[model samples]
Target: MLDDETPVLDNHLHLDPDNHRGIDAVRDFARLGGTHLLVVNKPSWHLGVEAETGEDFRAVFERTIEIVDEASSELDGRAWPVLGVHPGLITRLVDDRGFSPDEARDLMQAGIDVAAEYVESGEALALKSGRPHYEVDDDVWAASNAVMRRAFERGAELDCAVQLHAEASEDMTEVTDWAEEAGLPSDRVVKHYASGRLEGPIPSVMSEKDRLETAAERGEPFLMETDYIDDPDRPGAVLGPKTVPRRVRWLLENGRDEAVRIAHVETPERVYGIDTEATLERA
Candidate 1:
């Protein structure tokens, strides 16, 4: 309570055992006023460019659920899992394993289906799927878009929100179009790491202070993310989740209560479905 009175919800975090950032990172985040965390289970790594078996992916997801419980118990903050098939794996499979385009797409769908199953069973809250390492190759675009569309479709079928980790150039209009085609509303698809292109139809998480000011000026409501890599070597590769609350508190200190209320409280509760009152007991 010493940090800030306003309860904060971090919509994206990584407490993966594989990353192994250690519990101190979670404690540090809580100590700094992070109340709730959406712990996105890391997908396969781009470093080891190997094809992943469906069983291997499922095991990783199951471990993700376990880590969510562990983080919530060990840290004062509430933790939830965002399950998905990271698109980079598809690229690796095609590029390293010599998987044909169809094989890669099919493998991605299998992983997505598993994630959808977890969502339906209440093992995870939302979906996190994105196409990364995109290039001018029309085949890559075709495959990536198809994978993202399928992710949206799965989310729609399960009535869960979908968060994308796609290209920075991908705008809300394009995402909304895909979501509509997949039978989901625009607001349910959150464009993570959103920058530059603001004022989109869907909700997104931003980090820049000036852009945050711009969003406030336009009366645009969105969430904030640090993309917290939890890597000691990278040392806040994206940022530490604590950064969001610091920014929000600065705004609150400066008479930006309305903006803070909308972004931190209302928007997170509405979009990420977190109960702010029940979290960050350690903070």
Candidate 2:
């Protein structure tokens, strides 16, 4: 089992009090030896916020900060907010809200700007953005790419990391090129739900045995996450909150000590610029 002193951090997770386990799920993670989490904001519609403009995203970002505060105060888990426009929301804006593709693109960029403001204020540590994972028309795809590029720009300006939610792939040269052009290092861009063997962006590999081993074998910095959605209906659709700590314990039992420390401590510190040891002491 992972020792009590080890700092096990989940790179991506969500907590929703209204319809899911919320803080209790975080408590569960803590009970299993998880020390910290990057609590990304859920989509606006999920929180019942009908965002009509970039300023309207304030509600979503505020709620995310609120949730992070709640988790930090009420549980042993240490949490930070990663706020941004979810790429899939572009479709919601265009199809359901009667926005043109260009309009949706502009609004999403505005949302990224708002998220950057949070990062600048220190309420959030990182940004999140990516194109739709599913197939779409060429115009929608182009708009989504535009939004993601804006996110990179904001991340560059803020000098913070950007967590990406997009289709799974081993090659991300195109995305990496955009980050380079935006003046953000490609390593500062993380691919959520990623597996090992990716070519460009840092891989926040899912907390699975084989994937973790593959990422470790890559011989570079990487992080691990469960991507727990915290939805009661779907349950463990992506993975459960306890998965990270438990997987770390499994790795420890198998004598993968360096891998555990590199993933849970070193990579997070480098990517997010947080002191894992200090956070654990505070926790």
TM-score of each: 0.89, 0.96
lDDT of 1 by residue, 1-283 (tens): 3354576666777764655564666767677666667778776562132435554567768877887887777555577889888877766777767987778888887788888888999989998887774573667667777888898899889878888887765355877788878887777788787762454434455666875676566556677777787665676577776787677777778777787777767776676666665554543
Model 2 ranges with Cα > 4 A deviation: 74-77
Per-residue lDDT tens digits of candidate 2, residues 96-193? 88999999999889989999999999999999999999998999999999999999999999899999999989999889889989999988999999
Best prediction by lDDT: 2
lDDT of each: 0.71, 0.88
Worst 10 residues of 2 by lDDT: 274-283
- Please give the lDDT score at residue 26 for candidate 2: 86
